[model samples]
Target: MQTSVIISTYNSPLWLQKVLWGYFAQDRHDFELVIADDGSSDETREMLAAMAPNSPVPIAHVWQPDEGFQKCRILNKAIAVAQGERILLTDGDCVPRRDFVEVHTRLAQPDRFLTGGYFKLPPNVSKALTQDDIAGQQAFNAFWLMRHGLPFTSKLLKVVATSPFDEWLNRLSPARPTWNGHSASCLRSQAIQINGFNEDMQYGGLDVEFGLRLRHVGIEPRHIRYSAIALHLHHGHGYVTQGMKERSHGVKENTRHNRLTWAERGLSQWLDSSNRATLLRDDRLTRF
Candidate 1:
């Protein structure tokens, strides 16, 4: 089945370049990539334009005007135009391993959503990563990462394991499987059924909130944390505040308490908005 990989990006073109390279190096190439841009400058547009021509798969850019943190809004827009049966959500700052796409595709089930995890890199290592490293698939190597400054830890096993070992690690992992923005996938129908993300959220636990809604609707969350890996590039979280976290906490609590499946301010609301047509007809999305 065709998959649309939706990557949310802001103003980090340099990190985005690496993320795109990671996709380019994927073992599977049957997927299209949709970039859900939350109002970045012209630089990001130009970068995508320059890189799109050589991409192995189709690429589309869905951008919204910058009005603080409206990730859910832009993501909803991206989901509206995505022409795939399944959608994989991630961030531009996370570089996937070569087998990432294949793993997600193979593990996908009709009644479940897949959630993966990322191995974070420090600022120095994040900056040190090159396109060659990602394309060659060495960036995911534990020794290569250690050589480039990642400290040794048992977590590195997530980077080195193959086959049965990875599967065992995934089962043993304590981290709960949720709709992680860094690495997650679900059916397009499933996402649309509950109306996409909650626009009421602003960065803190928003992904978890979406997952809670999916769970409410009887979609099981499956763990692919060890098998589908991504390397998270370091960046500042200036947008995150205690207030945002508190507000998101409340929204999640409301979801659990009320068993709310539909989002009040999500995809359906965006589609019914007055400007939906204009946004869909814009030149930002590329057919190639």
Candidate 2:
């Protein structure tokens, strides 16, 4: 099946460039890239425009106005315009391994959403990474990370572990598998069935709320955290707050108690032909 990878980003053009380089190095190529831009400055637009011509795959930059932390809304907008049969959701700062797309395609199930995890780098490691490192896949190497100041921890095993062991660990882990925005995949139709992300949510638990709705609609969560990996570039979350977390919790509670399956305001609302045409004509979204 054709796959569309939706990368959410703001103004982190440098990290986004690294992530794109990772995609260019992927073993799998039958996919397109959709950038779900959340109102970045002109710098981001120019960067994307310059990179699109030489990109390994087709790229679409779907941007919305810079309303504060409207990630969910921009994602919905991206989902609205995506042309692939399946959609893989990730952040622009998360660089994928060469086999990332291959693994996601292999594990994709008709009635389930694939949930994966990321190896978060320290700020120093994140800053030290170059496009060459990502293209060469050194950024995902356990030894490379360790030499660059990654602390010694059991989690480090994920970088170099083999199949059965990784599978076993994923099965045995206590952490519940959920739709991690940094790495997750599902059918485009399945995402539409749930009406995409709840636009009311901020950065906190928006992904979790969307996953919960998918479960309510009978889309089971499949754990692939160990199998399909990505490297998360470290960045400060200046927008996240206690109030945001509380609000996210409240949304999660309401969805669980109410068994919400569809978002009230989602992709359907924005997919209107006239609306999409206007968005494209107004310089809000540019396809390349």
Candidate 3:
């Protein structure tokens, strides 16, 4: 089966390189790397272009001006041009294990979505990190977890079946399939036949909404987070920074609905980059 991996990037140049290189190490025979950059001013474009020529598989770039957090726009477009029947989606900040694709493919079925796992890190570390660094920060992480009071595990992320009516939702229940949006995921045609992601959602709800859409259409997600591990390069805080590293204005709250619109004059600055929903097919490229 042909697989297309879609990685969406903002201004995270250093992290993006590690993520792309991880793709090169995969054992899969057929796949493509689709970089949908959110207008990073760093050496991202140059680095991606340089790597494209020597790549064993195809690499394509889709870029637009910073447009807040419009991941759905890029993802939907990338899926349109993807050569693979199965679409693998992850972030520029995460690096997949060599067996990432293998695990997902093994678990994938026609009517189920696959949500893989990710290992959270601290600020700026790569997959090549030494075990000592991981051990040294164990204490720091423990304090951080207690202080934040956010739900997390040693592996950093966990998945759950969010279906309200499912038997799994009860107090005593057997483990059911799970769904979360951006670690590692594989969805078939049935999952997206209606629409991929609801572009209207701004912050965290979009992925969840899409998962709900899948369930609504009879596509239950297979809870496979811990099984297919990926490394999520760390951030200073638990949250990944969104806007201009200086201004810190892209973050939105329900009261501030204006932050959701990128069309405004000053608001566009908050958005690193964006593009209209479009599909660029291989037919547009000239042959040698």
| TM-score for each predicted model, relative to the true structure | 0.95, 0.95, 0.66
In Å, residue 162's CA in model 3 sits off its true spot by 26
Clashing pairs in 2: none
Quote model 1's TM-score: 0.95
The digit string of per-residue lDDT tens for model 2 on 88-120 reads 999999999999998999888999999999888
* Clash count in backbone of candidate 1: 0
Across residues 165-238, which tens digit of lDDT does each residue of candidate 3 receive? 22233333344444554554655354345456545444454455555555666777776655565667775432
Q: How much lDDT does each candidate structure score?
A: 0.89, 0.87, 0.56
lDDT, residue 193, candidate 2: 81
Per-residue alpha-carbon lDDT of candidate 1 for residues 51-158, written as tens digits (9 for 90 to 100): 998899999888887888888888998988787889999999999999988998999999999999999899999999999999998898888999988899988887
Candidate 1, residue 30: CA error in Å? 0.8
How large an RMSD does model 1 have?
2.3
Off by over 4 Å in 1: 272-284
Winning candidate number (lDDT): 1
> Which candidate model has the greater lDDT, 1 or 2?
1
